[model samples]
Target chain A: MSLQVSKNGDVVVIEVDGQLIVGNRQELKQRVLDEAEGGARKILIDFARAGYIDSSGLGVLVSLAKRMRELGGDLRLANLNDDLQTLFELTKLDSLFQIADTRERALESF
Target chain B: MHAALDIRVPSDVQQIEAIVAQVVRRCREHRFDGRQLSLNVPVALTEALSNAILRGNGDAAGKCVRVRAEVTEMRLVLEVEDEGAGFDLEACTEDPTTPENLEREDGRGLFLMRSLMDRVERFRGDGNVVRLTLNRR
Candidate 1:
């Protein structure tokens, strides 16, 4: 899995290029935490290229969202595929975070 | 795809992704439902292995996780066992979706396993074993 960070206006987008599972969840978490530490107040995790995420990956996202909130910022998700979306809904996590349909929408939400 | 598979690996979370992928790949080869192959297999297997490695074995050194799979056109059954004390099911069913627990990261694995698989039954034998079944239909 790979992560790429891009800046759009004041929002920072972290794009995940592969499935997020236990093997690489820590790296994704660290990347976002680093972004938060570096003054990124609004972050969007773009998962357009990502097709899967296990609960550990979800855990990392939950942790990152909480951390961002504690820092007076927020984390949002965008472009989740149908399978990934079903996962969020199945775990009732769809209600926990703001999920957008597109990067443009997510960026605008920030 | 093998009609049955018995795999033993170290109790490390990092080993989970590949195992999940392999299971999903085999299920796909056997013509399991695409939905199960794409979503159910990987998610359920990942959760099972993660539970086995992290919660079941406590990520303890030298411990091992054992995985067994039986795949057929009719169904897919997987069992993951870890060499740790059995876990309390009451504690694992706390409803992570509840407002009080929504932000907590520790509970979703078990919930997803139950939701995605046709059957999720846990019992103790050599260790804590989580058996997951998915009907191919």
Candidate 2:
């Protein structure tokens, strides 16, 4: 998967493209952690282009959300497709994180 | 006559998915009227592949997973072989469809494979060979 990070004031938006499977887990985790540590607490992860995500990828997201919470910030997800939404619901992570319909909504909430 | 394609990769999940997609496409191109069968074999093979790549020979040098697809008049057979220490398939038995196990992150791959494919067979004697078959009726 390819990731692009953009900064909008204090909020950091990450756009993930392609499959978020086990191979791309480490890089994805590192990117989120780095941005969180860099003082971009309110994070928006846009998953419009993400095709699939397995358990490993979900684990990384859970860990990042926990880390961001510990840092007095939050991680929000936007543009999640039906499959990913089902996945999150199945994993009970949908209730754990703030989800929005659009990037603007996610940023505005921060 | 049946056709086959052999794919060898460094156990990367993305590459594995790509290979699975290719196998599915090939089945479609061959005019197999089994969309569900195509989805089943690939999904199951992917789970087996992930186990080999992430937990098996991922840390070892020059380790890879080999996937082979064979199409026949009666069925579609996919064999995913990994170069890792094979484990007993009989030991793992967590059902993925169970409501209690849905939230857990691990132990779902094998279950999904068994549920989706018509036949699921594991061969630890041959370096972790997982054969999935879908019969076209």
The prediction achieving the highest lDDT against the true structure is 1
lDDT of 2 by residue, B19-104 (tens): 87787787776667654433455545666678777777765557788777897667778877887777777888766445665445
* Candidate 1 per-residue lDDT over residues B11-97, each given as its tens digit: 888787778877887788789877888888898898888878877888897999998898887889898999978877656667888
Q: Check candidate 2 and list the clashing pairs.
A: none
Candidate 1 CAPRI assessment class: high
For each candidate, the alpha-carbon lDDT, in order, equals: 0.87, 0.74
Candidate 2 on A1-110: residue-level lDDT in tens? 79999998888899999777677878888998888777778888999888766667776777788788899988889998776776676556787778998888888888
TM-score of each: 0.94, 0.76
lDDT of 1 by residue, A1-110 (tens): 99999999989999999889887999999998888878998999999999689888999999999999999999999998889989988878889899999999998887
TM-score of chain A of each: 0.98, 0.95
Against the native chain B, each candidate's TM-score is: 0.91, 0.82
TM-score between candidate 1 and the true structure: 0.94
Pairs of colliding residues, candidate 1 = none
